[model samples]
Target: MSKKPIKRLAFENLTIEFGDKKIVDNCSFEFPLNRKIRMLFNNDVNKYAVLHAFTQVEGITQGKYFFNEDDVTQFSFEEFMSYRLNMGIGFSTRGLLHNRSLQENLLLPLMYHKMMSMDEALEHLKKFYEYFDISSVKDRRPAEVGPNMQKATLLIRAFIHEPEIVFLDNPEMLLSKGLYANLLQLIDDQVEKGNLKHLFFSTEDEDLSDCIADGFIIVKKNKFEFVENKKQMRLAV
Candidate 1:
């Protein structure tokens, strides 16, 4: 059987500090991805890790980072934008425009990617609504929707553009056990369609790591190290 060609996106030796204090010291690892399964996950090793990864505002007095196998020893604005475009990122704290209807939020990513026309965008949105089991409430405002609904909608928005990789920081933050299967299915669809790649970050639940993940890398001392696992993951669990 033929398999989708997988390429290394980026892995890094992470070393970061906060105001003369060290956090993420020497973290190194690879983001394993492929056609059949490509979801790179990143769970915060420390409370401030997410802030450091996203904003790089403080912390990380020293450490190296990488994307698509390239070393990012230092962060730059232009490079960051370009990198984000090629890849996708989703975080719990990342705000959504709750003022708009669910349908509108779903359409934003498509618009950003300069994808199909209005009609096309609508059609795509409809598909996403169906996939997320929210077709009936497409016109509802985010405030009127359930938390799961909001999360599913935003997730669809992130992947609509089929980014090289989609980062879900702590996917289980609000996701329930019942939703885990559904979540994996949603991610599986993109891989099956050869549409997008994924990177999921989690801490408490290791099962989630093996669910929609092809492989996993652990972060420590600003370096990535892989743990060997012989267990198999089911498509439907």
Candidate 2:
């Protein structure tokens, strides 16, 4: 018999409601361990709510989810933390502190897990800083970096943790149209080199369709559709 590949993450029959509005409706998908994916949605999908569903850090009104093949409904906070350790979650607010250095902020998450030594964690941070081309700002405070650099640094923060699946919640939200292409190119290089599988979503991007592994689903009026980037050919950057 052939070996069954690990089911890295999934959302099955997920539906979330706020008052009478169903922000997410009966959504189902899988994140395989070795694949990179981009999820594109416009105004109606409630992007952050979809983001919350993956972590189960936010409560869902009705739905089922799994992380690394185990049901999320059965996990305790400790279990959830353990799950997080196995899968690095590099959220937007993951890095930086008002009074701390970028390097220090990067180490805080690893220290919170209590699994890596200080030296090991520092070395990891250093590598990501170099990989993402953010070493100059790594020593500087986030407030001191330029707007575009800040966004790139956030990506660096994500990459440093070595996440099997990273969620990029519009890290490029503040960048200009030109910078968008550069950031994507840099990230594509990093993903190929670092062996990362990630999910990113954006409302106004023109180039992500070609630069990343794209999978689109639009949820409006409680309906869903799977979109293919190639099918969106006439669209231009």
Candidate 3:
């Protein structure tokens, strides 16, 4: 028997389109494992489309998405579900269920995946709520909480299960200075503990990106360009 090659999280000859427009044209890049990557885009629409495609929240026009040697684009329902179990994604907006309480929203993934019991999930979430200072709004529905609280919940939910790869779309939006600092700290802690092996985030804040990202992925002219050095990333920007 031959051992399968490890591709990790990667996109090969990927193309994404919106209607008649090609957002990403035959882009191929393997996301480096155990590193924080900042995704840069020329425009919001392109950013949205590419990010959605990366997370499989939207369909790709063409190409393959590989995760640990498996083609995610070819995954069946069961396969996709299994693939998603190793991923944690935080959307910029409308990520939570409107009818569900904040606590419920954060707890669903952990419980549904059967990663832990209800008690264990809640107990696990307690620290996050405290750290993000959203404990008071836990029982409130998404509509009832402020944007910061809602965003905090979504961010917490992403890492709640300690998935191998985390995709955060515009993670800094609607967060306070203190809360944002706390978020960075949380990420540092997670990485240090070896719980989060890969993190890809799109943020409009260049300073934040420069401060945290180990590398840069620039999405422009329907292509994905990788920059491993901070100086090169700045020049690319």
Candidate 4:
């Protein structure tokens, strides 16, 4: 058997502020690798705020972030890009490029990351297309494809390079339950095969708490807390 990848991530007294208001305040938690985590938020704003902070859309005002035992707390966006390619972020693809073909949208990332050449990217795309049964619309632009296809494209782009950690933002809102289940299965397979070490999915649905494999994180009264039950989370919310 192959040894599993070690891609540990931790937040030590992490805080993010928007002017006078603090979005994430003094949050401290370490996400366990080789497990699935559900990130529950009190509201949509909080959901987006946490995701943005992780993706560096906003700045961290305090504390340290450790990845693979290294303090990357002060790393800039450019620094993150040259780092281990440890993280991947996914959002709804409804607003994908209208001018570029779907294939181009997916191929560009592979090429930019130096993961594959044009011919290699095309071959990789073909495999994913066949796996998702999206080959028919592979050449079409985003606007021409249906919602399901768009969601598939987005997911493929997110996981094509097989990053150690993946951050999914409101995927349930973008894909149907069937698609969501498939996505979950994909993550599970990756985890089992040691291809993915951690998966963090953020959402506002209280019911999603049941899907937590290793507990869930929630924003309670503007503070991030990890919990096991939705009822207790409701009290904090």
Residue 134, candidate 4: alpha-carbon lDDT: 78
| Model 4 lDDT tens row, 135-182 | 888889988987878888777777777777778776666566666556
Worst 10 residues of 4 by lDDT: 1-10
Give Cα distance to truth, residue 167, candidate 2, Å: 1.2
lDDT of each: 0.58, 0.59, 0.80, 0.68
Which segments of model 2 are wrong by more than 4 Å? Answer: 1-8, 18-21, 30-33, 88-95, 175-195, 198-200, 232-237
Q: Candidate 3's residue-wise lDDT over 48-124, tens digit each?
A: 77777877735576888887777878777675776677678998877899999999998887877688898888899
**Clash list (residue pairs), candidate 3:** none
Best by lDDT: 3
Q: Write the per-residue lDDT of candidate 2 for residues 1-237, one digit (tens) a residue.
A: 111223466667777765567787776765544544455555776766766656555646666777657777666767576556544444544445757767766777778766489988877677666544667777777787776666666666665555545667665565556665565665666667754555544444545545665555444425544455546522411
TM-score of each model, paired residue for residue? 0.72, 0.75, 0.91, 0.82
Residue 126 lDDT, candidate 4, scale 0-100: 80
Candidate 1 TM-score versus the reference: 0.72
Give lDDT tens digits, candidate 1, residues 1-237.
112223654434456665555556655555555532322233434544633463332354444555544444465655455555555555554456878887887787667657668899988777666666888888899889777777776677667666656666666655557777776777778767866655544434667765655554545434454543424222211
Q: Please state the error at residue 60 of candidate 1 in Å.
A: 5.6
Whichever of 2 and 4 has more TM-score, that candidate is: 4
lDDT against true structure, model 2:
0.59
- In model 2, residue pairs whose N, Cα or C atoms come closer than 3 Å (at least 3 residues apart or on different chains), thus clashing, are none
Model 1, position 35: C-alpha lDDT score = 31
Error of 3 at 25 (Å): 1.6
